[model samples]
Target: MRRMLLTFCLLSLLPVTYAVACLWDSETLEQERNKFPGTLEVITGNFPRHSPAFYQWRLDDRLNKLANDPDNDRWLDDVAVSYEKLGRHSEAIEVAESQLQRNPDRYETLANLATFLIHDGQWEAGLRYIDRALEVNPDAHFGRERYQRLLVQYLLQNFPDGQVEYPLAAGDRIDFPTFLVNDQPPGEDGQPPKLSIEQRQAAVQGVVGMMRFSQHDHPVLLEVLGQLLTETYRPKVDAKQLAARCYLLLADSAASPATQAAYEQLAKKSLNLQATHKSGSEGQMGLRAVRRELSGELAAAKKRYNSIVLKEKRWIASGVDVEAAYRQYVNSVQW
Candidate 1:
């Protein structure tokens, strides 16, 4: 009877022992878990035995091990990216910043922080970091592209009023207008202020200079710049020339067949305008060659470009060197 009672008591104590063991493991895991505020909440809400949180917890252990090792900073990037994937942007930013303090020249970490900042709506600061990343490694293709995109997003959000202020020269500021209008009408005073062609050109140059400094080969930025140039120069400058430049920009940046077709249609319209206006200037000639190349008329394009390269030294009105432009065209079409 005493042996039976002893076995029963041991079995009862087995449940207590298992409970104690579970509590100890839970406490240890809690201590090992990331101390970031939202981490626990996320883990609790989707509490599976082996959830993302569980995996992340394991990753954190590795990260902790490598925390003081500069040679293993890539693990920090991995942890930051994991946090970002979990939508813990704040924690991602924190990790990126912490790693950057140790190695300020980490371009990848800088980009990661910039991305998180942009995602968190801190666009201005994000752009600053992106600029820093570019300064750190100008040859970073991905960083450059991301910087262009983030810049466009920042401009779109902040400059929705369609007005951009830029400097033409030192201490000479200009407020360039970006309002698209089919025709320039009189102002509210019934007497429109006539801006000279020089003034219009200056404004266009200022905006272009700003974009050039930003390293904008991006399609979206090109599109925005095209619109701004067209709007700023519409009635003040030659319409065909304006259309030609816009068409070239749009065409060169077009990535898809549909987009290429749309820009081609616009270029055709410019060609028609050139015919109507009887403006057979060097700009028109260069645009014609470009259009031929785009239409797969390689022989005609080569013939036209060869003629331009041999005869025309420059297209001064548009500030393009004919020979140089022809070389670029050849390079683009050769592939």
Candidate 2:
């Protein structure tokens, strides 16, 4: 009786939740607003209902239209991709999966479903699809390499903590050296080495610095130099060139996370500015007190910050990318 009641409750909640999910909102409506700029009220419950379900419901209609009409396969890929982009991962997965069912060898749909599943954190499910995808035709898509990398990353993330005393798991077949040899081949077990506590601390600091240079008007060279110095020597990034490349790559806006973070920073920064103020600080600290303060203390504080900054100048010599030049300024500590 209790199990039956629980099942009934869950069944009842389904439609209730689904109904709420259907309600259009300021966020959703606003995102769509730009799909057709200048046509603010151009869509909604009125015109053909650009409902979230439209893709599932009207896919047939669109495909029928495309069949009689000449259009690129991109038309279908676009619809699936767009839905996935909108956070409708399940919907995207459904559409892509349905298409794959009809065409078992469709790498695009299978790979895309695998992506949506992984991004949604359905790791086991995602891998299952990926395995099926491989069986579909192993070499069908060269891009599967990226999926394998992601698979390695995911496995590493899920590696059992403290399960065994060995530093590296059996699946972590490759040591740092092994991976380096095979272009950082993922351990057969799919796990990345668990960073040490010290390494974790450095990574946190490095990522924060990355955030600052990424968002603020700070010099990229200096930020990268400082971060790499701390990470490798202080924290210890043994792969100097690889780390440098990662930082430079992020700074260049050539990579996705870097590009997204950069633009978001730009947008947020564009919205902020120092406030202008109207006059008020003249208690004229009895000229004696003012003189005492400035002459005795203010100069010291100024010199400290100045000294810290001055120490950074030596790195300018080898160029931020070079080690010998920066090693002295940053000091050689294990990152």
Candidate 3:
């Protein structure tokens, strides 16, 4: 639930069939917007909806339980999560901090604290907590913490203020793979690559975990997942199809028409989807079908995600060591 609550998405000027290769300047964004027909509205209402009242009820219930059993400490996370869902990030952080102060070894509390901090735009602080959480249980969440660490580092390095200046693109072509070893063997010279096979494989696992557990709408996550799929060969996964879905979602969440257009162009150019369609309108029709398919897939994934959370709770009740159990589970299924 924490994973689902915190993840988010973003955009270019495209609709469904394009991809973006580089970041655009403000002037470029405006110029592209002018070239498009009608304005592309920022998409909303598609995600699984939860009412504010539902969160308020959950918060009240958790608070009541905490009042009854002040020493239990279990209710703290529930309260914090409810607060976060209600848009009270400061309160969430406060609750999580108190929980951490009480039991610093608790992995969920550590991760929740990091998430709340990130939600509040405290990227550096969030990174620190994420590091602590990783130390507590690096294998938790299917090793997804590593990717989060890397992502925060990238964001802090490129945009210290935690806001993207323009629509992100891969430039004339998608190129992050150049830095990674991917599926290939080590260089003949026997030198290590910047992103070795192990690292790339682990990062792909993290991205897959995020896609399965978190909301599918977050643009940064989508973009990174798309990039990883294109670069790293994941057995049995349709890289081009999945990457197209990621860009399609990007277009949906784009801030302006120009950004949406850029993503659409990227999808078509990068995925070679245009070669099949006779016209842009035909390509759009195909994209709509793909979008519907992706949405259905997301819904099923959400159900599986909820089941995992429940399974974790049950394991805790049965006195199971969750981190060790999760590590075993990751080992069993990991690529």
lDDT per residue for candidate 1 within 1-335, as digits (tens), equals: 99999987887777552322111122322342322122222211211112244335535655776767745777777777768656688998998998888889888898788878866757677778878887887666523434344344545444545343221101332112322221367667985554445543443443343344322333434444333333322333423333344456566556666666666665555444222122334323336554443344334434554544443333423546443654565455632
Best by TM-score: 3
Model 1 TM-score on a 0 to 1 scale = 0.32
How would you encode candidate 2's per-residue C-alpha lDDT over 1-335 as one tens digit per residue? 99999987887777542322222223432342332221211100011112223333335445656676523445566566556655677877777776776677776667677767765657667677777777766764443333343433434443524122111212444322223234344456996434444443343343333233122212332223223222222213222222222233333343356454553333222111211121123311122222332243334534543543444343333235222433453354221
Best by lDDT: 3
> Which of candidates 2 and 3 is the stronger one according to TM-score?
3
Query: Each model's C-alpha lDDT?
Result: 0.49, 0.40, 0.59
Off by over 4 Å in 2: 1-74, 140-143, 146-153, 156-335
Let me know the TM-score candidate 3 reaches against the reference structure: 0.62
Cα error of candidate 2 at position 103, Å: 1.9
Tell me the lDDT of candidate 3. Answer: 0.59
